[model samples]
Target: MEPLRTENLRPLDVSENLWDRIFTVAPLVIIGTVEGNSYDLAPKHMATPLGFGNYFGFVCTPRHCTYRNIEKSGEFTVSFPKPDQVVETSLSATPRSGCSDKATDVLQNLSVLQATTVKAPVIAGAYLYLECELFRIIEGFDDYGLITGKIRAAHVDKDYLKVSEVDEREQLMKNPLLAYIAQGRYAKISETFNFPFPKDFKK
Candidate 1:
């Protein structure tokens, strides 16, 4: 095969928003929390499991209710929506009206269930649910805060489970997952391939 041509890149202005240019594909999950007497669900794309432990973290802005609610209550739930539940996930991000409660409105429209270890709610038809307690909140990132949580309990749909006896690709095709492309895009991921590790790789 011919070697691909490469172009030397030059530094651009820092004022340009570079997140979209990075093209990171992240899992789209709805973060559920308790706000006053109501429940709040917000969709977050910049989330990932921290290290190999039971810690999960997401980037959140202080202006959002999710951050405030978590700060107040110290607990939250995470729902990993399936491809078919994209509408519900998007609905959770709807802005609140000045006169009415947004959380009440969202719960009335979407299907949710009470979490086991947390006081928050989780989307009912989601592929996975995680109940978490706030571990730490790291600030000093300008306007964004990194909220880390200690996962207390987790639940997964049997259909989406990777069984040792079953083929992984077949299971994924049966239950397509939802992915978020940064900068206002989403993908339904059903196809996958195993990573080709070099021979004699050490653990």
Candidate 2:
């Protein structure tokens, strides 16, 4: 075989570019609810997918408040925002940014639920909610802490299911979620092309 020609393989920008790509492919919205206050951060920097097949979950490493809370409480929640809630979703990811206030201003009326296992609150209007318990906490070399949450429960909204014929595609179709990219930048699923999974996908 001929020597492989070098192409786009270049140094990854750890901050803006590298971190963003991880969140782009499979976005995860993490809600860190502690005390009476709820602070959310949808991490753009995540580890490779772990767990069993389609039932797998993306890794999340928190460097600030969320990490502190999860380290203390050993529990957290991940909620999928609805399509219409993309703006709010993006705002929630902002760490101490004023955008969070703006997003909350819009979603002030949104309902929140108490987590069964964790102190963190769940978005009542979210498409899906995962109640997670801290399984492992790996301290990274950088200013980040890798948190592995074992999903104890997965809650799907009732309104999202009108019949026995539940189609994840159809449910997600209506709520095309938001994704993190760079410094305070976001992208919508509408702009990206999607493909269906194979029939033999492991659950």
Assess the local accuracy of residue 16 in candidate 1 as a C-alpha lDDT between 0 and 100.
73
lDDT of 2 at 152: 80
State, as a TM-score between 0 and 1, how close model 2 is to the true structure: 0.64
Q: Which lDDT values do the candidates have, in the order given?
A: 0.90, 0.58
lDDT of 1 at 163: 79
Q: Judge candidate 2 at residue 88 and give its lDDT.
A: 52
Work out candidate 2's RMSD over C-alphas: 5.4
After superposition, candidate 1 runs with Cα above 4 Å error: 1-11, 97-100, 200-203
The digit string of per-residue lDDT tens for model 2 on 59-141 reads 44453556666777777777776656665565555544442342354235445667777777676567777777877777764
Clashes of 2: 0
Q: Count the backbone clashes (under 3 Å) in each candidate.
A: 0, 0
Q: What is the alpha-carbon lDDT for the whole of candidate 1?
A: 0.90
> Which 10 successive residues of model 2 have the least lDDT summed?
98-107
Per residue, candidate 1 scores C-alpha lDDT tens digits across 66-125 of 998999999999999998898998899899753136888898889999999889999999
